[model samples]
Target: MLRTIFLSLCLSLPVLLPAASFAQQKSWSGTAEPRNEKEWIRAVQLRVNANAVNSFMTNRLAGTGRAKGVAALTVEIASDGQIKAVSIRTSSGSEEVDESLRRGVMALPQMPRFTPDMQGDSIALVIPFALHG
Candidate 1:
């Protein structure tokens, strides 16, 4: 009976072992160091210009006749090349302009990787969109 019990216990061990092994695995691979601000800016620029910068060219809020302003956005790009979240870190002070900026950033494709800086391989991206000069 003892031998039979031991075999049963051994049979269950493999299933239990995998759960423990998986739990010990790390969530992210490849270190995320500080990324170059310039590089991030360039990425944003490329994204904006991919289809021409015309998408954000004008805003007619309440028929005000095309206001001019710049919108700034800060986004955190995960190591997986996904835009984790975006916030209007700075804005052109117009709701229309700000919303447009947010929309443009949201429309960007998922980035896969970024270069590292002193901060250890993490990247913070900022995108600025200008409308009406």
Candidate 2:
């Protein structure tokens, strides 16, 4: 009986796995957007952090020493997940660092799409970044 159950479970995994994967994809692909503004902001932050890490790993970012600073940027993201615009809300005390951050955000190919429940054509986010040398 145990062997039969194990065999049945194994056979069912392939069918179950695809359904799970599709549901996950649908959730992030804009079918099920974040439930609120806070959740949306968190999602955006996560994506930015991930991109920054990837860029740093690839040596695409400026030298660590030069990039070190704290900065805040007001970014406008379209409902479709495009970065519409980026403006520095608080400077990093270095024009180079500020511009670098702005350019990096603008260069992104895409961002998380606005949650379907979110009310607006676009959302503005004040994202803070602190780089350590």
Candidate 3:
């Protein structure tokens, strides 16, 4: 009986792991869906520190005396509030500024928890960053 129980557990481990992973993924994606608009906005707001972002970009792209443009960022955050990807959908014209913006998003300090399962396996959101240098 013990041997049989051990075998059953071993067989179920793989299934259980994937189910958990899938659940996590679903949660992340669900956050941005129409049903969870409030949670989505809160997640986006807490993910990045605007002050830190402004400071980093200003310092990194001080060239030309100033940098002015808008970067459209699509960020993917996991259920546990981990940033998986930060993609720049639209550029600010200046390569330096664009790169800095991406870096800042990637280096976001923490993903604030406004609600449980706010950050699923992945959430895709477009956020605009206005750069005025």
lDDT for 117 in candidate 2 is 66
Residue range with the least summed lDDT across 10 consecutive positions in model 3: 1-10
Candidate 3 per-residue C-alpha lDDT over 46-93 given as tens digits, one digit per residue, 9 for 90 to 100:
334342254343555543544676666666665545667877778878
**Model 2 reaches what TM-score against the true structure?**
0.61
What is the model-wide C-alpha lDDT for candidate 1?
Answer: 0.44
After the best TM-score superposition of candidate 2, give how far the Cα of residue 127 lies from its true spot, in angstroms: 0.6
Rank by lDDT, descending?
2, 3, 1
Residues 11-105, model 1: lDDT tens digits: 11011221232222232223232267455444434443432233343332323544355555666666555666667866667776567556645
Q: Stretches of candidate 1 above 4 Å error? A: 1-41, 49-54, 57-64, 115-122
Candidate 3: segments with Cα more than 4 A from true spot = 1-40, 46-66, 113-120
- Number of clashing pairs per prediction, in order: 9, 0, 4
Error of 3 at 5 (Å): 45
**Clashes, model 3:** 4
* RMSD vs true structure, all candidates: 22.5, 16.1, 17.4
Q: Total backbone clashes of model 2?
A: 0
